[model samples]
Target: MVEQVSVFLENTSGRLAELTRVLGNAGINMHALMVADTSEFGVVRIICDSPSKAKAVLDEAGFGASIANVLAVEVPDRPGGLADLLETLGDEGMNVEYAYCFVRPQGSSAVDVFRVDDERASSVLQAAGFRVLGASELYSS
Candidate 1:
């Protein structure tokens, strides 16, 4: 499971810059990130090389943070690609709490990291036509 650091920030200007600067100054590398915002606050979820370090830095900076385990599944970069996977999970009675997708380059495939309610990720992956890639696998290739 790939661990993600979720940071809560005020929905104002310079908040993201400050957070990134703090992490950058602390020598933390953010590999992937997703930001969802409400009217008052924004949730920035990140996958970094050192999740604990990132959380510590955020805490020192007075930002509310949390760490969660997510499943990084590689999916085909095409229409209905995600639908196929979702159908499989639905068939097996696995609910997807939330998910985010990111594409590599023009020549490579895309990857979607899903945050599931339970640790039924293995079963979901086996049932779906997707490959559950580990963090090492994500870094290696």
Candidate 2:
């Protein structure tokens, strides 16, 4: 499982800019991000090089931020790659509550960030021949 930083922000102009500024000032590099919003507020999920540090800085900057454990599964870049992964997980009875994707620097494969209720999903996927990434793999310098 990888640590993801989730921040709550108001749905106003420059809110995202302010959040990014805070993270930037802390020298935290955001590797991936996803935003879900309603009329009044938004939930920003961020995968950074240092999750703990990111959360601390965001809290100090007056942003509501916390860490979540999510699976970073590497899928092939070709067609049907994501579908196949989801199908396998479904067959194994794993439910994906939410997910997001990001391309790795190598470009050979894309990493899918999956929020599953079961922590064992990572080991299960690895045993099923999928490459479940770790913090070092996802945040390598």
Candidate 3:
């Protein structure tokens, strides 16, 4: 499992930049990010080098921030690699709530973030032959 930082922001100009600026100034590097939104507001989910610190910085800066446990999995950078993982999870009756992908710079693989229905989805994925990364693995990568 990994800690995913989520920042709630208004759907207005400079809000995204402000969020990034705060994290940047605090030296928190984003490993992955995804935004889910409607017309009024957006939820920016991010995996960073320092999740707790990032949450604190965002909160102090008046941004609504929270954290959740998510899974970071490594998939081969090939066709159907991701599909295979999803299929395996499906076979286990696990449903993915949300997901995003990022290429692994130092390896021949891609790292993906996922919000799954089951709390033990990570362990299940690992047992099914997938590489589920720890928070440290993502931060270091």
Candidate 4:
């Protein structure tokens, strides 16, 4: 499992930039980011080198931030890699709540970050021949 930092912000101009600036100023390097928004608010989920520090900095900067555990799995950088993974999860009765992907700096594979409903997702996926990444693996390319 990897730590993900989630920040809540108003859907206003400059809010996103301000959040990024805060993370940048704190020297937190973001590996992956996904944003979900409504008309009035937005939630920014970030995979970073220092999730705890990132949340702390965001809080000090007046942004509501929290940490969550998410599974980071290695997937082949091929057309059907994602589909296969999803299929395997479905076969095992695992439901994915949300997910995002990012390619590493020096790899032929992409990492898929998932917020799944089951706690056994990591073990199940590993049994199904997937590499579940921990914080060190996720942060260091």
RMSD of each: 2.4, 1.3, 1.5, 1.4
Question: Candidate 4 versus the native: TM-score?
Answer: 0.96
User: Top TM-score: which candidate number?
Assistant: 4
- TM-score, predicted candidate 2 vs. hidden true structure: 0.94
Kindly list the per-residue Cα lDDT of model 2 for residues 76-128, writing each as its tens digit. Answer: 99999999889888988989999999897877899999999986788788888
Whose lDDT is greatest here? 4
lDDT of 4 by residue, 1-141 (tens): 899998888999999999999999988899899998999999999999878988999999899999999999999999999999999899988899899999998999999999997988888899989999888887742
Question: Model 3: per-residue lDDT, tens digit, 34-100?
Answer: 8899999899999888898899999999999999998899999999999999998899888999999
- The CA lDDT of each predicted structure is 0.81, 0.90, 0.89, 0.91
Better-scoring candidate (lDDT), 1 or 3: 3
lDDT winner between 3 and 4, please give it.
Answer: 4
**Cα misplacement distance, residue 21 of candidate 2 (Å):** 0.5
Which portions of model 1 show Cα errors greater than 4 Å? 105-107, 139-141
Which wins on lDDT, candidate 1 or candidate 2? 2
TM-score of each prediction: 0.86, 0.94, 0.95, 0.96
Output the lDDT of residue 116, model 3: 95
Candidate 3 wrong stretches, greater than 4 Å: none
